[model samples]
Target: MIDLQQDDGLWTVTLNNPGKANALTGSMLEELLRIAEAAQEARALILTGAGRVFSAGADIEEARAGLTTSDLWERLSGTIADLPCLTVAALNGTLAGGANGMVLACDLRIAVPAAKIFYPVMKLGFLPQPSDPKRMAALIGPARTKLILMAGQKITAVEAYEFGLVDRVVDPENLLPTARDLVADRLVADPIVASGIARLCQ
Candidate 1:
């Protein structure tokens, strides 16, 4: 399940299936993609989770049904990456598997201290979505990216921050607030100017 909340030009998207660690299903991925596409007009967007784990990646049944290799993951991440707005992944907890793609695509990432980040494509016998590795390498560097994807090392939030995978490690209660604060300036600035700077930075 996904919940979307909008306040003026700010949008917050939350993954709500906590019973499964917010594990994503094919339909959930579709909804997330739709929301990201609709967020094009937003000044800022925050992507977060409702429980202790951001996502366990694809739901077990869905993954076994070919969700692991689906194109929707790439489409969703690409849509987020192309948004002309400040996008932040407010990771509430552990982040694993293909869920890394959307988080990697965000303009910034802030995770709770308890969070652990990993992608087990190697062990799962599937290559990550096409753009995920490139985006991940851009944030944390090629070797570090390899550590997670190739060697299947699960890194703590602090390690992720040190490797540049996550921009901040916050107390769980402050996660969403910190994400909003990060995008505050963009929300009030001239939209055109803010988006122009974002493009230039890219």
Candidate 2:
């Protein structure tokens, strides 16, 4: 499930499936992609989760039922990367599996101090998509990327910040406000100039 809240051009998306660690469903991905498509006039986007887990990644039950999200995964990440406004992944809790790709797509990643991030593809007997590994390599370097994808490392929030996977690690109480403040600062820059700068990173 996905819930969107908007105020003063900031859209905060809360993943609401705490019952399942917010495992991503196909419809959830579609909703996220919809928001990305419609955010041209917004100032920034903040993504978080409603309960204890940011996301457990793809819904295992759905996967067992023949659901596939590979293309949807690419579209959602690509759309976020291409968005004109700044994107912030407010990693409020544990993030795992395909969730790694979701956060990697954001322009900035800020996490609560207790949050954890990991990729379990190797353990699950699957290789990460070429794009996922490339994006991870770009964020934290190829060596660390291999450590995650090849070694299936489980990265704590502090470790993530230390290694460049996250830009800031704030207290749980301040995660949303911190993201808001950061976006406010980003807003001071000319939108066109900011857009151009973001394009260069693409």
Candidate 3:
């Protein structure tokens, strides 16, 4: 389940299947991909979750049905990565499994103090999507990325901030407000100039 809200040039995308910790199904992934592709026109976009967990990654049943290997994961993350606007992953809670890809692709990440970050692809016996490792390494460094992907260590919110995986760790109530604040400047700045600077950083 995906919820997309747009106001002016700002877009907020929420994962709404909290019953399953927002575990993604193939169709849900498709919807996210479509939304991300369309968000090219947004001045700023926020990706968040409706409940305590950002995502548990692929739905268990769907993963058993081959959703884990689907190319849609790559497509969705790549679209977010190449977006000509500021994209922020407003992590409401723990981020795990395949869901790491999209969050890793975002321009910035802010997490709630209760959030934990982990990717256990090794334990799951599946390779992460192609860009995931590189994007993760770019944010937190190769060794730290390995600590999660290889050793399967679950990192705390404060530890993630220290390792540079998350830019800020805030109170749960302030999560969205902080995310909005992070992109506030870009929302009002010249679109071309803002997007240009974002591209230069990549």
- Give each prediction's root-mean-square deviation over alpha carbons: 0.6, 1.6, 0.7
TM-score per candidate, chains pooled: 0.99, 0.93, 0.98
Ranked by TM-score, top first: 1, 3, 2
Question: Which pairs of residues have clashing backbones in candidate 3?
Answer: none
The TM-score, computed over Cα atoms with residue i paired to residue i, of candidate 1 is 0.99
Write model 1 residue lDDT over 1-202, tens digit each, in one string.
8999999899999999999999999999999999998998999999999989999999999899999999999999999999999999999999999999999999999999999999999998999999999998988889999999999999999999999999999998889889999999998999889978987897
Question: What is the C-alpha lDDT profile of model 3 across 1-202, one tens digit per residue?
Answer: 8999999899999999999999999999999999998998999999999999999999999899999999999999999989988999999999999999999999899999999999999998999999999998888888999999999999999999999999999999999999999999989999879868876776
lDDT of each: 0.94, 0.85, 0.94
What does the lDDT read for residue 193 in candidate 2?
84
Give the CA lDDT, 0 to 100, for residue 7 in model 2: 88
Please tell me which model should have the higher TM-score, number 1 or number 2.
1
Clashes of 3: 0
- Candidate 3 local accuracy as lDDT? 0.94
Q: What is the lDDT of residue 61 in candidate 1?
A: 96
Query: Across residues 1-202, which tens digit of lDDT does each residue of candidate 2 receive?
Result: 7899998788888999999999988889889889888988787999889887899988998766644446788888888877788889999899988877768888899998889888888888776655789888988899998888888888999999999999999998999899998899666778888877877876
